[model samples]
Target: MSSATGPEEPDFPAATAARLDGLGLLDTAVTTCRACPRLVAWREEAARVRRRAYRDWDYWARPVPGFGPPDAPLALVGLAPAAHGANRTGRMFTGDPAGDVLYAALHAVGLASRPTSVHRGDGLELHGVRITAPVHCAPPENRPTPAERDTCRPWLARELTLLQPALRAVVVLGGFGWQALLPVLRDAGWELPRPQPVFGHGAEVTLRHTEPGRELHLLGCYHPSRRNTFTGRLTPAMLRAVLARGAGLAGVPCRWRPGTPDT
Candidate 1:
């Protein structure tokens, strides 16, 4: 609950994220971040200039917080919040089409309590899995500049550090998250390969942590964006399989359903 400018006022995100001791405090600080002016404006503008379908709903225009348990064994990393989705729900990936598919896949892999995430208070839950993003705010055109990404990375790094004790696996969605997360992993104690790993759907890489006998399984999967899903690049089964692998590596049990994908 502490920060450079005290608990009530958080200055730089990197400084703030570096000092925060727990995920709850980190989430609170993330929501109050206005460090990125462009993102702050865009998120608020989307809230004020409402989408017709969501006109009656109050939008959570601030930076969205990562969702799920504090002691998760597996973590799912995403690029950023969809402008109309997480930007409106206050929780990462909630109220979005991608979330619908992502949560469903998690449910199939026994990582989520439900197949849908409609809002922050939808009563849905995750089991041994935490979902987060590189950027907390919704970026314009769904693209965050490299500078913005860098500015936001301390949060992710800090989150991963907090989860490191229990974390055994990480599933990164899309190339952006893959690229953003590598440096964080290296800085957090995992040894990066000689050549940086290239991202691809279903790509899997095992990393050795500085601590003896500590290992991490990193998996890549296509983002469940409409383009990927509609083009069959990332199907229900494809997404489910990668999630299952990530969870399996964490030694978390999966309650298999009739057609759950296995990696």
Candidate 2:
């Protein structure tokens, strides 16, 4: 469960462990992954250079793992880590504006313990929800190429499989995450529609379970990036609505409202 201590070449041990190990072991392996050459170089470079504001800080500078309870019923899929965000803080959607919007909405809907996530040890907790990404390493300019996405797919696929027992709904953030997640879900034995469901804010699709007891739902939401939030393309109310819907689909009650007191 230790972080990568130095720059290393992309290796297969981590990937193998992700498929064979349990949640805790898988996450530890994920942090040490160096599967993509470009991603490995970029994430390490960013850490070494350091941002002006965070010059005094030490960056995690490794692949970021999914964060939250192992048996979470609700899951969230984000595109990738922000260069100075998760790539620095070692936690998904932390230390960034995008996280600010997302965690706040989750908190308002009674999913997250706090509305703000500054770092890993900030005491923020997610109730029945886990946050993950297609690409663990932060790519340059906040974008991972198609090859990189495909290379990183196994980790997510394994993660979903491990979560299948209790996972009922997944909220994918942005079109990238939506596209990236669908195939993984299908590969994990969920029966996706032939035409495939399109991605859009508030878009929802229910896939039949391979085991035939209950279905799994896929929910979409616009990424809570600063671009969308600052431009009015996405509002707190909008994000909260989508999350509330997902919670309901998962059979989880969301008692917190727009003006409800924080838990």
Candidate 3:
């Protein structure tokens, strides 16, 4: 019953800030992005149609911003938001099956305050971790075309640039994210290895920072989507192992102790 508008380009800040204000400004701008016409249409339609189960819920219907502490040492990148998941809940990986596996593993590894992320204001907290995506909007069929991904890249680039000072490691959820993120990392002053590392479960690559005395570690993990989880391509143990390894490389303590049983 509601009418949706076409996509509008975002107005980036004239200059990037070095502290939290910069991140805050960029996040606000991310939520307002409407650069991809197809994505804007799809996201608005999904919100307007309203899933029968969530008929009473109001959809965010905007670009989903990255979620986590500004100074997080570990950054987790995913492909994009789910139409009925983040699009409905306004938070990355919330109200979805993939989030169920992800938050559980994060909790088990002690990076998350809780084992679940049901909604945006559910008191869930991420310690030394921030979850984001290459594309901010929910796309039809969960796939954003190459043009859409490229159009949405500047937001991720700015976020990483702002986070570089504190970021020591990154965990890419799937091949899409791994590929999308490498260029951003390179532009942010990381010296990526030649031939570029391929994405695989538990794959690790270390890169030297352009800034002296700093380095970054990149870890690849199978996305916690139903396709992978249902097929056993990614197990709880496998996900936890990658998270623990990433934390170690980032020089952060894993809350989940060794031999801790999975929830």
**Among these predicted structures, which one has the highest lDDT?**
1
- State TM-scores per candidate: 0.94, 0.92, 0.92
lDDT of 3 by residue, 1-263 (tens): 11232236432221221233477888887887677889999999999998899998889889899999999999999999999999999999998899999999999999999999988888999999999999999999999998888778778888888886899899999999999999888887889888989999989998888778988899999999999999999998889989999998887789665577766
Instruction: State model 3's lDDT.
Output: 0.86
Q: Write the per-residue lDDT of candidate 1 for residues 1-263, one digit (tens) a residue.
A: 45555423324777788888999999898887887888888999999998899999899999888898999999999999988899998788888889888988888788888888888998998999999999989999999999889888988999998886899999999999999999999988899888988899989999998888999999999999989998988898888888888888988887764374443
Task: Give the TM-score (vs. native) of candidate 2.
Answer: 0.92
How does model 3 score by TM-score?
Answer: 0.92
Q: Residue 68 CA error for candidate 1 (Å)?
A: 0.9
lDDT of 3 at 176: 97
**Model 3: how large is the Cα RMSD against the reference?**
4.0
Question: Residue 253 in model 3: shift from native, Å?
Answer: 1.7
Worst 10-residue lDDT window, candidate 1: 1-10
Clashing pairs in 3: none
Off by over 4 Å in 2: 1-18, 257-263
Q: What Cα-based lDDT does every candidate model obtain?
A: 0.88, 0.86, 0.86
Please give, for residues 1-263, the per-residue lDDT of candidate 2 as tens digits: 22342224333533364556578877887887777889888988988999899898899999999998888899999999999999999999998999999998898898988888988887888999999999999999988999889877878888888886899899999999999998888877789897999999989898996776879989999999999999999998889988988988887779755555545
